[model samples]
Target: MTTALVTGASRGIGRAIAVALSERGDRVAVHYGHDREAAEETRSLLTGDGHLVVGGDLADPAGARAVVDTALEAFGGIDVLVNNAALAPSPATLHKIDETSYEHWDQVWSQMLDLDLRAPANVSFLVARALISAGRPGAIVNVGSRGAFRGEPDFPAYGAAKAGLHAMGQSLAVALAPHGIAVTSVAPGFVGTDRQEQTLAGARGEAIRAQSPFGRVATPEEVAAAVVYLTSPQSQWASGAVLDLNGASHLRT
Candidate 1:
């Protein structure tokens, strides 16, 4: 069976990815940042004998090692790695951003850099290296955001970080190609996760929907299906690409 390691598997799109992989008979390592209860719920929903949960704060460099090591020990090896965990919506303007305090511009930007850009790149490299050392081929799917291409005026730092992630994915794909590893980025528009639903209940949500061609947002399952496809052997020839799962919502200029 194929072994897939999925980060941020506690909820939202991450949980859906884990379930889809498991349903397809792939062994899954559900990685969680904090929510153990939610992680356990995801693990319980998964089928098959080798499905397991591994939790750690991936924002820390060492935590990244712990996550990979545990999965390796349990699954024997990994064939796919999904970098999906992320923090969101810092809610600040460019000029208003202060570069001083812990929650200010610099710190917030650093946190976003660490989690969104650095963590994914680090994980991809380590996993790719492991597979290369063993003379095996693998897949790396980095969860990206439409904000990386479209400007998020309210969340500039996050947009910047995701933009960096998009660039990183492309570079890694080329760098790891000779090593027999495939790397790609999946950029999605607004999804109907719990947090996203709550935000939609707030002001400006209706207005945003009205602008989209679909007149609605995407569901977690829809995005999860894309992940499963890209990570599967069926998509082996499709790498170093940015697959837009955004339903043409960002097409309107």
Candidate 2:
């Protein structure tokens, strides 16, 4: 069975991806930043046994390495890695130009890039090296954001970081291809997650849904399903691809 490591698996899209991988009979290492309880809930929701819970701050290089080491210790080896952990846009993280102070902007930009871009790159490095040393084929799926293409005026850092993440995945895909490792990324638009429920129920909800012809936002499960396929062995040929899960809300040429 495949041993998968899913970062930020405590909730939302990360939880859904963990569940999907577990349902497919892969032993999952659910990594969380702080919420151990929520991570345990994700572990309990899995379909099979042998699931593990690991917690660490991905922004810190040492913590990121420790997370990978913990997963490796428990699972013996990691066959799949999902870089889903990120500092998403929120009221506290919003830094719109002209409205926010330069200091605030710098702080938010640093934080977003650290967790969203650097963290994933570091984790991928550790996992890819392990797979290579063991001489085993593996796959990596990065959870990127559509904001990288459509832009986020209020959270420019988030958009830039995601763009970097997608580019990093392509670079790694090419670098690791000779070792039988495939790396791909999924850029998802607005997803209906617990964190977004309030916004979806507010007055702007209709306008948000109207962005896509389908008249609704994508669901976390749908994104998770795409991740599942991208990380599967059969999808090796799809390496370096950046799949869009935006429901046609945003298209890139």
Candidate 3:
């Protein structure tokens, strides 16, 4: 059975991906940043015994190593690496972006750059490097967002980070092609996850749904299905492509 590591698997899209992979008979390393109980719930939902529950702050280099090491130790080697974990900027526009107390504009940008862009790329690099050393061809799927393309003016930092991530995925696809490794970015539209439900609460979410061409937002499962297919043998030759799973509302004319 193929072994996969899925970060942020405690809930939402990550949880769905973990369950889907497990159902297909692949062992999964479910990585969660916080909320151990939620992570365990994900593990419990798995049909088989190949799922491992790993939790830690991936922003730290050591923590990142632990996430990958534990999975490798348990599953022997990783066949798939899903960089599904991310953090959005707190509710504030560029005028009020003060989450980081850096003295200069460049410094703050660097901090945001590290968290949103560098972390996933670093983690993917670690996993892909290991796979190369072990003589195994693997797949790396990054859960990006349509924001990477849309460039929300209110959330410039996030959009920039995601855009960088998409570009990095393309570069890795070419760099790892000779090794038979595939790197793909799965960009989802406004997904109706728990966070979305709470944030959009009541009439606002309803109104937004009505505006969509499909009259509803994409679900976590829909995005998970895309990730699974990209990792499957049918898409082995597909890499560096950004698969937009939006509901057609965000399409460019």
Candidate 4:
């Protein structure tokens, strides 16, 4: 049986990914930042047994290590890793230039870069090392953002971090290919997760939906479905590839 660890699985896209992985018979480790109750709820929504709920503030390097270590010890070894945790853009996270103070700008940039980029790097390192030691071929998928390709004027740090994440995945893919490990990323434009309900219902709802020709935003399950394929055993050839999940909203040449 395959064992997978999914970070930020307490809710939103992370929860959906966990559910999808569980339904496909892989033992899942659901990692949350500081939401044990929500993680347990995700654990409940899972399809099968052997699912685990882990909590850690992954922004901290030590916390990232602890989460991966616990999962590795409990599962003996992990075959898949989804670095889905992130500091998404919101009212509180927004730091636009000219309007925001220098101190606030520095704070947002530092926090976003640390949690969104460095933490994933740390977790990937730990899990990849574990898989190598175990002599196991595995997959690591990162949930990046379309903002990396487009632009996040209000959240420049987020865009930079995600772009770094995509590059990091490609680099890891090449480095781990000889060991039979694959690394990939999915860049979704605007996902209508539960947390975005308020924004989706507010003034930006129509404009957000209109970004796609389908007149709708991507769903968490849709993203999860893409992950299911990328993380599957047959997709080893797709290593180093970054798949776009936007609904014809943003096209990259």
Candidate 5:
């Protein structure tokens, strides 16, 4: 059976991706940054047995290696990887250029770039090398954000990191093609995940939903559906693509 590792699977979109992978009969390695309890809960939601849970602080380069090694050790090899772990744009990460201090700006920028961009780069490299050595075709999908194109006024670092992620996926797609490893990314707009529930319930909820003609934000399942496709063997031809899941809210052109 194909085995998958979904980083940040402790909750929200990551958890949804893991569940979808499991539903398709793939064994999953659910990874969390710092929440072992939540990661275990994700394992309980999977459809099949043999699903594993791993935890590590990917911001540290060594942690990325540890995560991949743990998953590889348990599953023999990882056929799919969903880089869904990220430091999203919460109040903690907010750094609007105008109102933020230099020290806060540096802190947020460094934290976001390290975890959201650098971590994925390291993990992708490690996983790609493992796949090449084993001579197995595999898929890597990065969960990007529309903010990369639409503009994250409040979280510029988040936008920049995601933009870098998309570019990295495209570059890796070309680099890994000869080895039969496909790479792609999905740029989603505002999604209604558990982490976003408070935001969607607050005063700005109406404005956020109004951004799309559908008058609603996307669901975690919607993003998970995209991941499910991107990580499948049938989607090999779709490598190098940065599919936009913004509900037509932000069209790039």
Candidate 6:
């Protein structure tokens, strides 16, 4: 069976992705930034044995390497690496130019880029290198965002970082192909996760749903399903692609 490492698997899309991988009989290493209890919940929700719970602050370079090393040790080898951890745009992180202070803007931008873009790049590098050394064919799927193209007025740094992530995935895809390692990314639109429930129940809910023709936001499972497919052996030829899971909300030319 394939071994998969899913970062930020404590909740939201990461949790759903871990569940999907486990359901398909893959051994999963659920990595959480914090919240050991939540990570344990994710492990318990899995269907089979061999699932592991790893925790670390991915924003730190050493922590990111330690996370990969822990998973590699537990699973022996990781066939799939899903870079799903990110500092999402919450009220606390939102830095609108007009309303936010310069210091706040700089801080938020740095934090978001560090966790969202650099962390994933570092994890991907570690995983790719391991696969290369082992001469194993593997896949790396990055969890990007539609905000990269659609724009995030209130959270510009988020959009910029995601854009960089997508670009980095493409670069790695090309670099890793000769080693039989596929790399790709998914640009998902707004997803209906538990963390977003409050916003969905609020006054702006309808407006957010109306962004897509289906009049609803994407679900975590939907994104997870796509990730499952992208990381499968059959999808090796689909590497270097940034598949859009935005439900036609925003189409790129």
Q: In model 2, which regions exceed 4 Å deviation?
A: none
lDDT of 3 by residue, 1-253 (tens): 8999999999999999999988888899999998999999999999788689998778787888888888889988999988888876444324234443445445546666666688788889889989999999899998888888887565666788888888999999999989989999988888888877775677678777874788989889999899999999779777989898988867754
Better of 2 and 3 by TM-score: 2
RMSD of each: 2.4, 0.5, 2.6, 0.6, 0.7, 0.6
Tell me the whole-model lDDT of each prediction, alpha carbons only.
0.85, 0.97, 0.84, 0.95, 0.95, 0.96
Instruction: Count clashes in each candidate, considering only residues at least 3 apart in sequence or on different chains.
Output: 0, 0, 0, 0, 0, 0
Better of 1 and 2 by TM-score: 2
Tell me the spans in candidate 5 whose CA falls farther than 4 Å from its real position: none
TM-score for each of the candidates: 0.93, 0.99, 0.91, 0.99, 0.99, 0.99
Report the C-alpha lDDT of model 1 over 1-253, residue by residue, as the tens digit: 8999999999999999999999999999999998999999999989887788899988888999889989988988889999999877644433234333545666667777888888887777778888988888889999999988888666677898888888988898888889778888899988888768767888968876765688878889999899998987778778888888788877624
Q: Model 5: per-residue lDDT, tens digit, 1-253? A: 9999899999999999999999999999999998899999999999989999999999898889999999999999999999999999888989999999999999999999999999999999988999999999999999999999988899999999999999999999999999999999999999999988888999999999999999999999999999999988899999999999989999999
Q: What are the clashing pairs of model 4?
A: none
Give candidate 4 regions above 4 Å deviation: none
Clashing pairs in 3: none
On a 0 to 100 scale, what is the lDDT of residue 83 in model 3? 86
> Residue 49 in candidate 6 has what lDDT?
99
Which 10 consecutive residues of model 2 have the lowest summed lDDT?
225-234
Worst 10 residues of 6 by lDDT: 70-79
Give the best candidate by lDDT: 2
Off by over 4 Å in 1: 90-103
Q: Itemize residue pairs with steric clashes in candidate 5.
A: none
Q: What are the per-residue Cα lDDT tens digits for candidate 2 across 1-253?
A: 8999999999999999999999999999999999999999999999989999999999999999999999999999999999999999999999999899999999999999999999999999999999999999999999999999999998999999999999999999999999999999999999999999999999989999999999999999999999999988899999999999999999999
Candidate 4 least-lDDT 10 residues: 89-98
